[model samples]
Target: MPPDLDPRLTPARPDLADICLRGQVAAERFVEGRPARIAVPSAPLRRRPDVAAGLDTEAVMGDAVTVYDVRDGFAFAQIVRDAYVGYLPEAALGPADPAPTHRVAALRTFVYPAPDLKRPPIAHLSLGAAFAAQAREGEYWQLASGGSVFAGHAVPLGHTEPDAAALAERLVGTPYLWGGRTTLGLDCSGLVQLCLESAGLVCPRDADQQERALGTALPPGLDGLCRGDLVFWKGHVGMMLDAERLIHANGHHMAVAVEPLAVAVARIAEKSFGAVTSIRRLAMTAELAETGAFTPSAAS
Candidate 1:
């Protein structure tokens, strides 16, 4: 059998082997290709079917997923965004729809029952949750989800924030939760992924994966650090706010925090993560260039 087809699609996650490889190794036939979409603001993708199981990632509202099996109240599925397979509550899914028209750009926003902000909210959406806009009412956009959101909070599809590091700063003090992607809680990689995704860059879910996939390596010293530069240590990552400071969601403070890069490096090395592995500078997207967020010196 091909190495990639040995029923372990994600070698890091052994728990999924049974579900992903059932047809090949057991008599149980695997179901294929049932389209679905996330119906909630954010849905937890767990390592197991139980609610208490360790979270693997999150599927935000309107994310496309392919269901391969349904058991109890959970669905075994693969997220279309990153091809990450996991289990999420079956109740959080609904029929797939066309691509969303806008995405929530604020840290959090409410979906009011009507166009009036005074009315009660029907749903609360987090940053990066995509929604289809059906119409405009006053200062609100009517969502296909049957609610209206403030127009200022939703940006047209393909609109991206130019300053990813500045966007991440807004999330300061957010509680750190493993596998969390919302403002309610976020892990290190989740923080990076959310900020970058809002800037229209695709990012992977885990620290190791992000380390492997993002940016070009810089010299092995703090001298090269700059705003938006990525610093990686074994199993952890942080984004530099400037040459002196970095912002990260970490278990040390148990929240997103900023500290002097040198201080953080010493503390993290002494206590947990052993040493810095690499320093990387990301390329500027066209959107960033227009906003002058990236300079020639910053890229180096």
Candidate 2:
């Protein structure tokens, strides 16, 4: 089997088989229910149908999810973006909207009660959260939810950032949180996903899934590492800032930090993470690099 195809890359959620990834139950059971859309700025995707369960990931506002079952005020569903199966509170979902106009481009922004900035904020939105625009005020975009966000902090649906690596640099000091994907806190895969998604590249929600879904594998070794290269170890990943340094949201530091590649390798191994498992690079042309238009090749 190809190295990237290792079964460990895909999470095994056997306990959720009837309602999750495997979908062992009959389709008719879920197909009859209407598809739901995320209504809040962000909702926790949990391992079980309870608030106390571990968070598996987060679904942003306007993201679609197919509801399969509901129990104890929770909805068991699969996120449309990455097909991740989890349970979310029923309150987090509402009638679906097939079209969304813009996505949050800033690390974090407030949703104002009115178009005026002086008005108190009604809610907060994180980067990559989709917003449906109803109208444009002088300096804000009025949302269908009756909240207004700064116009400059959002971009049209299809807009892509020029450099993902450069974008990741902005989160250098963010606190690390397991299963988080926001500026307030984030994990290794969350860092990569946020950075690459901002560049209009599709990315999965976990380090292993990301390893299997993005970029071409490079020959093993540290000799040819470059900016934007993805370096992977068991259950963890980091991006190369250049040939010799890497940045990652790590437990060791409990924050996103940059460290010498050699030092990081030794430290991780000392903690029994094992050696580097793979190195992958996104292919880009000199012109694309200059223009900041990165097109990541799907994993092979």
Candidate 3:
């Protein structure tokens, strides 16, 4: 190892394992893809950090609620479900979901359902884990565990609505895994879809589908974007804010983070080598909006 480099960091990188939306573009052209940032429940590509690897370590087991925070050199997330909250990295799991609901009487848990592809019989979810909810009530929730929704616990602490603002803020630092969606990890459109769905909205899970759901087109510029507006390019998507910024769970930078809209636009432009695409409003059709369904794109 070179003395100039950090000692705790290793040289191995990560890779992708899956994609929720079929025929999605690669991470190399995030902005050009569509929603500038989405969710990826699959393990992402990246190198290992030796020193930060063991620093302030906390175990995120099954049925845990974690909140992604910072993403400087490495990804950082804290468990917010129950008592399991702290910092962890992005390279831990294969294809994690966003707030995946799982119930475990102990450290050992099982495959969530749709997530139970091979029917792992009793696949184990560690303590301090994460899951995406498909069903919910007072104390229990149905999640898209491996691929289906089984019963589980640990949803948002208080209320659960499909508010884009709240959902956008939730996945703040989630690592940008290639196919991950859990607090365990996330990607660009995956972030948008996950948080929106959790809020009670029913938008499409992919960027193009999202473009269809949004209805209105972004034109050629973003002069009138407000918070919760869906921003899309070619193969990527993200949330735009009145603060002249956008937030998305991206794979290029490899995590959820805020970026200047100009910088983001520039990055996408450079990558695609083309003009900016479209930006869509989150507001639903007149009928839909009148019904007060403009909370979140993923709200069901």
- TM-score for each prediction? 0.88, 0.86, 0.46
Model 3 CA lDDT for position 299: 28
Rank candidates, lDDT, best first. 1, 2, 3
Top-TM-score structure, candidate number: 1
**Cα-based lDDT at residue 298, candidate 2:** 15
Clash number by candidate, in order: 0, 1, 90
Off by over 4 Å in 1: 1-30, 285-300
lDDT of 1 by residue, 169-219 (tens): 999999999988899999999999999988888887788878888888887
Mind giving the per-residue lDDT tens digits that candidate 3 earns over 1-300?
A: 234432222211122211321234222211111111112222222223334332222333332323232344334332222122223444443233354333222222455334443554434443224455665543335544433323443434333454565656766777776544456566676677666655546555456567766647755676755567778877688886443778887766788988887888888787752445677765533334457544223322
lDDT string for model 2 (92-152, tens) is: 9887875679998898899999998899899999888888899998999999877899999
Q: Is candidate 2 or candidate 3 better by TM-score?
A: 2
Score candidate 1 by lDDT: 0.83
Q: Which ten residues in a row have the lowest lDDT in candidate 3?
A: 29-38
Enumerate residue pairs that collide in model 2: 162-292
